[model samples]
Target: MGELVSTPLPTQFGDFLIKTFSSGNEDIPHVALVHPEVDFSKPVLVRIHSECLTGDVFGSRKCDCGDQLHLALNQCGAEKGVLIYLRQEGRGIGLTNKLKAYQLQEQGMDTIEANVALGFDADMRTFVPAVAILQSLGVDKIKLLTNNPIKLEALKEAGFLTVERVPLIGEEFDSNRNYLNTKREKMGHQI
Candidate 1:
């Protein structure tokens, strides 16, 4: 991966340096929002978030993605952390398939069931790119902001020296209760 560009971004959460990382073929590059006061000497706070077009952009209540993202941003802003926005929409199934999966969900399938029906894994996302981004930033240790055990495991599997998990729980809503249940029950998310 190569860092294509970086610039200062002032958001309501905080002022940050946004860097774009691309693998050349991807039209949408992964991004890292770094707080101005971020320090590398100690374990830095980091959040590796996959893109959720419906939830993150349009505020869909089918899942708690948008809430989680906002919470992460706020925490990152306050703690001088980094938020890596990975372009792995729908957990790597892409937007169209994600929409299709949503249709299936409306027909009574759970998230994983819909993805499987679409002939894809429950979560096809890879943490390799996120790890690469962190490495590029010279971040050896991290206090990962997430409730997904997969994220913590991914970092350790990549041989990250010190990886601590910081819980990032999203608000539970009636619309997303089942969705969250599937994640916590079937996918082993630490909710």
Candidate 2:
């Protein structure tokens, strides 16, 4: 595991601090958001969100990435939890290839098919560093908020005590319906 190198930044949200950490592995940058008044000794709410530049940054309608992010931030802020933003664009295929995959999706290909066509796995993200971040913060357990079962399994394998799975249910739209379905069916996510 890499060293926990993080620097805090200010946020408008109540007593929130954001930190960007280097992955030390040339994959994606890892980030951690610490909320005010969180008890490090107790289980915290954690959201392991993979990078979705188009939706997260530009508000693209192809998926619910941005909405999920915003919702995670709000929920975490309210409950004094943590949000670990992993920089695994397009499920760890990186940005350039992700854009190419987007073009393929526009041509009627689902997210999984687009990645497979591009010679990548359906979901290429890893969770080792997420556990590292949690450990660095002295967190031993969590109430995770996510629809991806892979995340829950990964955290369990990493030795974190995941006491509960808090479903992050959001409104579905026509644009993101197929994407969500692919995640539920192919990726085994509990959407």
Candidate 3:
């Protein structure tokens, strides 16, 4: 994917230079929110976040996606970092299938079991696009904000010289306890 457009975005967190990267999908381009003073010469602080419509937009309590997203944004704003928002909805299963998985979860299955029963992997996302975006922006070393071990390994395997993982913890609720447990136990998330 290549950068398609860029513009200024002012938000509660701060003013940002927003860039969209796409492979012809205008409606669902991967987005990058860059702080104005971000220093690419140093190990840039970065957060590669996947889209989560239900949780992120609707404030669904079934997971902590929205909470983590806001937390990352706050940190990025405070630290003059970069936040890469990937359009990999529902761990790459797309939105409809994700809803179906939620149905399965209501039937007493954890997140992993629900996705597995739907004939998909526990997590089907790839970090290739994130790496590409960072590279295109002249970023080599990074302090990645994440709780997923896969992200750490993915960046390391992609040849980032100094990939330091910065843990991003969020508030937990009863509504998402099981989901968090599934992530921490089955999916190897450092929740």
lDDT of 3 by residue, 1-191 (tens): 56788889998888899999983467888999999889988888899999999988999899998998899999999998999999999999999999999999899999999999999998999889999998888889899999998898899999996558899988899999999999999889998
- True lDDT of residue 176, candidate 1: 94
Compared with the true structure, the alpha-carbon lDDT of candidate 2 equals: 0.84
Candidate 2, 1-191: lDDT as tens digits: 44445555556545566766678755545888888678878889888888889988999877888888989988888899899898888889988999899899999999999999999998899888788888877788899999888788888888888999999976689988998898888888888
Q: Which stretches of candidate 1 lie over 4 Å from their true place?
A: none
Candidate 3 residue 166 C-alpha distance from true site, Å:
1.0
- For each candidate, give its TM-score against the true structure: 0.97, 0.91, 0.97
Q: How far is candidate 1 from the true structure (C-alpha RMSD, Å)?
A: 1.0
Q: What are the lDDT figures for the candidates, one per model?
A: 0.92, 0.84, 0.90
**TM value for model 1:** 0.97
Worst 10 contiguous positions by lDDT, candidate 2: 1-10
Which TM-score value belongs to model 2? 0.91
Error of 3 at 186 (Å): 0.7
